[model samples]
Structure formats: structure tokens, C-alpha cells
Target: MTDSMSDTLNNEIIVPTMAQMAAEGKQPDILFWVGCAGSFDERAQKITRDICKILQHVGISFAVLGTEESCTGDPAKRAGNEFLFQMQAMANIQVLDGYNIKKIVTGCPHCFNTIANEYPGLGGNYEVVHHSQLIQQLINEGNLKAEGGESFKGRRITFHDPCYLGRGNNVYEAPRAALEVLDADLVEMKRCKSNGLCCGAGGAQMFKEPEPGKKDINMERMNDVLEANAQVVASGCPFCMTMLSDGVKHTEKEQEIQVLDIAEITVRANGL
Candidate 1:
């Protein structure tokens, strides 16, 4: 389970291909759904790697669709393009059905929400789980452990609830439970959980210019993180990470504050 990052980046990653597993007449325990951001976005790709590290360390049998994966249509649907959303959803469903995928785990909440809640109506029902939820289950099941003296130990950390994961899916405890393993001083934003503010990337706003407003929503959300005085802002969604990172930069607090995903902390704590 102990592996250097470079080793992981090279060839030690335990990820298998669904095609390979299928050809061997084997089905993986869960299909790791690397979303658009995790696949293409540079920042999110790190989170994707960390999640894979955690999964490998915990000995979870997993496989990714790789090039076969596509957009979950969360953004398209949020942008009010129902036609495009359905088109994307059905295309993805065909691939999932083709592989007979039963369980799924994603680092992006947008993908988690879309495939979990919205796909049932499109005949793509499956056990879809957010990475945080899976991590929490692993921790609770004594499969994942965070050793002491790791990074973020006794550091001030706060969690930013993503719209799709928190209020949209009511997943409030999983990320926090995952973070608690760090033994850090877990802090909460003034606006958190069900009352959390949007990071301004929701609703396809990230792809377009913002409308007239006194200040950007990410800036406003940054105000809460700053007020919380957290050294690290832990996020579960990639869009939230981008929006909050921009918010921190806009507020000139990047040097003082850091934005990280829950999986990053876990990987660090485990010394992976």
C-alpha cells in the first residue's frame, strides 16, 4: 500500500480496465467514474489521482471506463439544455449497460448527482456513490486509516459543501467524517451544510460570464471561508474547488489559504 507518488504516476497504480476485467469474466467491485474535470482539468486530475491512490491503498477492486466515459450532462441540464442533457445521459447509459456496471464512484459531485438521482428515470439505475461517501465507508469499515503526524495534523481546516452534494443530495456527514481522520481542528463556515452558498460555478455559470451583481458568488463564498479563518478549505466537488480557488485568488488570500479536496488530505494522512 505504501507507494511513492512518482511510482504511482508511473506504473504501480492498481487500476484495471473494464474491458480487461470483462474479458477475464471478472467484474470489478466498483467502476471509478472519472468525470470531465477529473479527466481533462489539471487541478481536478490531481484529486482524481489521489482518489485512485486511496482506493488502491484500501484494496478496493475498481476499474475506470477511461475514454469511454463522457459528461454526465449536469452542466448541460443546469444550463437549461434538456435536449443535450438527455442525449449525453443516454449515450453514457449505453456504455454503462454495455459493461453491465453495477456500482460507481466519482470524485465530482455533479457527476455523482446526475448519475445517481437523474439517471434512474432514464433507465440507467445503479449504485452510484460520491468519493467522500465511499471513503467514509472505508474508514468506518476499518479499511482506510489515517496515521498520526501527517500533513494537516492539528491544522485549521474547513469543509465547503458543494451544492450538488450537500443540499442537492443531502450528503453532509461523509466528507466531514473522512476529514475527521486527519485529527485536524475541523472548522465550519458560517454558511455551511444545508445553508451553504453556491461557489458560483453551479448552473453552468462557470462556462459563461456572470450577470450584473455587486460581487461574484465565489467572492462572496470566499468571504465565508476567510471569516472562518481556516488554513485549508476542503472541497468535494471539482467545480467548487475551481470557484473557491479563484475566489481565494480574487481576495488575495492564496498565500494564506489553500483549497484542497477531501481525498488529498486522506492521501497525505496515509503517507501514500
Candidate 2:
């Protein structure tokens, strides 16, 4: 969108708490699940804030888990530790069940995949959606309007699909719908959709060194972005954001291209 999609929120943000809603004997329309990255990673935190800004702008009743939230164990499970994954999932399930949460939305695809697919068998079952999907729904229902050409009017942007959200879950349209509202020239990589390339950050590879390949997965993936001649790289997952940002830097194209989350782009387009 703009030169700085990660611009700080100048407006006072009002994010409700599940506990506070509970005290009032009420429930939120959706639970904003700030996954581990959204809660702790500096860059990912901005996506979290932007998603909140959009939710607030659209007047949606959403609340965060706050202190009651824990890791979804996506990383742990992907690292091949089923026992640890189960333990972490069970702990989060307990907290979610305690709150009686019904619907969930998160900025991380890792958490989205884990909660929506993996958590069900462990006694955690809730309607979970990625922030991009939620934003698309909002836009479709006329809850979010970004029709005015704010920024990213005709910029060449390419979407980098995360494995968890795409191949793992088969969610390919929601993120694109959110981008369509920006009026940007959405380009496609040679390897996209079902054939999309991984950003090299999935399956907990982000927490460990690579396996001595000729080139890092992210670098290879970045090549596709470069080939598309995109001005901005749109990503829907926080993990993809980190890896793609690194790839842009590694290619020394940080000034020429930008890596932004879908929520960040949506907020910037809507002037949130």
C-alpha cells in the first residue's frame, strides 16, 4: 500500500478482554487469537494491532485471550514432537473451553491450521478463521469499505501463500479477496496456489538452521517474487512475513520491495 504499511496506530485502540466480557455476563462475537508470533514477535505484533484496528473500525465485538492464551504448538508439532504438541494443545483447549469461546480469528496461519484442524481431537472445537478470511468476509458484507483509491491503487503486488493456509488447509481465495479491495494489480508467481512455493519458515524450520541446501527456501521463493516484478509482497501469515522480509533483505531489495501482512495492507487502504 503506502511506503510504510506497518505504520503505528495513531488512534486509541479499544480491544476488549474475554475476562471483562465475562464479568459483564456477555461474550464476544469472535476471539482474536494472538498466536505466539502475534503476541511476541515485534513485526507480527503490528499485524495483530492492525487486525484489531480493522475489527474496531468495522465495529465488531472481538476480544483477546490476554493472559489466558498460550502457544498453539504448531512449531512444536511440526518439529516432530507429538507429545509436546498434544500437551500444549490441551492446555490451550482448557483455557478456550473455560472461556466458552465459540469463534476465533488469528493473524498467524500456523495457529489457524493448528486450532482449526489439529485442536479438535484434543477436545477443542471452535470456528477458527485466519485474519485474511475474516477481513474478506467483512468486506463482502459491506462491513469494511476500501473502495476509495487510498494507496496501492495500481501497484504490482504478488501474494506469497503460506503452506499452512494454502496446501495444508486449502484456503486460497480469502486472502486474495482482501487484496482485491486494494485495487492493486495482483500478480501471480509461476508456482502459486496448489503449486505454491513455501517461504521456508513452515514446519518449525524457522526455529532451526537449514539443511545445507544450495539456496535457502526463502531465497528460492523470493526469486519467484522477483520474477513477477512485484513492488510489494503480500503475505497472510506472520511466519511468511518474517521469512519473506528476510528474503527481501537478503536479495538487497529491501528499498525496492516491501513485505506486508494482509491486515496491514487492508488497514492502510481503509485509512485505519
Q: What overall lDDT goes with each candidate model?
A: 0.90, 0.88
Candidate 1 residue-wise lDDT at 252: 91
lDDT of 2 by residue, 1-272 (tens): 12122322456577778898899998988999998889999999999998988877777778998888889888989899999999999999988999899999988888999999989988899999999899989989988878542588889998888898999999999999989878789999999988999998888898999998698999999889999999999999888898899999999998899999999899888778
Q: Candidate 1, overall lDDT?
A: 0.90
* lDDT of each residue in 8-121, candidate 1, tens digit only: 546366677788888899988899999999999999999998898888777677899988888999899999999999999999999999999999999999999999999999
Best candidate, lDDT-wise?
1
Write down the TM-score for model 2: 0.94
- TM-scores, each model vs. reference: 0.94, 0.94
